[model samples]
Target: MRRLLRLTFRYLFLALLAWVLLSLLLVVPLKWINPPITMVMIDRWINNSSEDFKLRQTWLSWDEIPTHATLAVVASEDQLFPFHRGFDMNAIQQALRERERRGQLRGASTISQQVARNLYLWTSRSWIRKAIEAWFTLLIELTWSKQRILEVYLNIAEWGPGVFGIEEASLHHFGRPAAQLTPMQAALLASTLPSPLRYDPANPANHLRNRANWNLEQQRRLGGAQWLAPLNER
Candidate 1:
């Protein structure tokens, strides 16, 4: 029992050390060397490793995607991406209150947090996982520029089964490049993020259409991507 305890302690120490090193790598100069890996690559790797997981298929660069595409996503998913440090405390509080009212579990992870989770963490829901997610999110925000964060988010966010980034999503859905996706197409894509499997962009359900329309209105109200236009150019 004593030997087992020692071994457990040793492993725990190693795990903690590795986690710290990884956090540093993600947040520091190491990221400069890693370049950016797209969602398409990640999805392909996941699919190759396991028969259970499969993505629709898509990949896009920051410039390849239209300004409205980013705006639509931000308006629909996270309106305060430019201001948030990493987590949106207000949204978290609201989500918790709503969950209590509904007697169900819900989430309010912002785009930055979601990017951290999707890029580094596994698809598991637990307090421990969430804590790790928060840590990585902090690191990402500290180390990466806002433009880099959004670029990563756009490339990695799952649009549909096998469809990964805006580029692939635009080509698959509208037979156009992501840079050319219209406001309606961008809004439709943004609407699918909540539940891509359930919401078909080609034939949006009533609820999805309403949600997309709402996002479009929000984008228009926010000055049509003026905030993110500069980022897209970078």
Candidate 2:
């Protein structure tokens, strides 16, 4: 009985040690190295049986993606990205209250949490996925700077079927490069994030146009692109 208990404890310790070391290995290089692919991208590839399915991604250096797209997403998705760590407690609380009132869950994921999920986890909502997402979120918040997190998020976000990153979305949707994305164009792309498959940046509906216009207003309210200056490395 004692020997069995000792072996169980030893195995548990080894497993934990491996997990910690592995997380460091994964999170550290992402500060400088772009991920070649993300788990969700892989998931999409596996599920899509169409011959037309192609992963539309073109990795660009941070400078290659225009500041307009970055701030636009920040305005549309997570207005508090520059200030918060991994989690947004107020947003979470608000979501919980809304859920209680409406009997339906609402997403309160901050950009950092979305980054963690996009890179490491699946899209399915469950207690287990949320727990793992929380774990990755902490490890990332501890290891990566805010700039690195946003860079990864912009690159890996799925804009449409097979469309990933601002660069690809720009070329595919707007016939331009990411660097040349105008404010309105950037806002349009940001608006598609919530339901990329349903919304087309190339041919936006009336609702999408309204959302894009709203995003631009929010971008201005957040002090324009200058709001991101602190995250920029001097």
Candidate 3:
């Protein structure tokens, strides 16, 4: 019994050590290296069976993706992207309160948290998955700058059923490259991000149109592309 217990503990220690080291290896280099594929893309490729399902992604460097495209996502998804460390406590608190009052879950994930989960995790809402996501989120924030985080998020984020990244999304939606995306076109893309599978940016319905317009308004409110200047510093 003593030998069995000792071996169990030793194995557990090794497992924990391996997990930590693996996470560092996964995150640290990503500060400079773009990921070839993300877990989210793999999940979509495996599960999606619709006729429209087509896997596509094109990496555009930060400078290649226009500020309009970048700012639209920041305005629509997480306006606090440049300021938050890894999580947005205020949004989390608000989501908690909303769940308690409405008995429905709402997402309050920051851009950093979304990057961690989309890049490294499976699409499950289990507590275990959340815990792992939090671990990766911490590692990402610690190892990479805010700009790098957003760059990865834009590159890896699923824009539609199988379309990924700003470049592919721009082409898929508007028949233009990311750099040529107009402010309205960028806003339209941003509006689909919350429910990319459900909302079609190419032929937006009434709600999507309203949301895109709202995103455009918010972008102006956020002081346009200049709002992202802080990301350069951190």
Checking candidate 3 for backbone clashes, the offending pairs are none
Q: Which of 1 and 2 is ahead in TM-score?
A: 2
Worst 10 residues of 3 by lDDT: 122-131
Clashes of 3: 0
| Residue-level lDDT tens digits of model 1 in 95-202 | 789978997657789998988778777675777878988998898888787777887788777766666778878877788878788899899999898566677897
Off by over 4 Å in 2: 1-4
- In model 3, which regions exceed 4 Å deviation? 1-10, 50-53, 102-104
Q: What's the lDDT of the predicted structure labeled candidate 3?
A: 0.89
* Candidates' C-alpha lDDT: 0.77, 0.88, 0.89
- Candidate order, TM-score descending: 2, 3, 1
**Cα error of candidate 1 at position 175, Å:** 2.0
Q: TM-score for candidate 2, please give it.
A: 0.93
For each candidate, what TM-score against the reference? 0.81, 0.93, 0.92
Q: Lowest-lDDT window of 10 residues in candidate 1?
A: 30-39
Question: Candidate 2 lDDT, tens digit per residue, 79-139?
Answer: 8888887899999999999989998778889888988899988888887888888888999
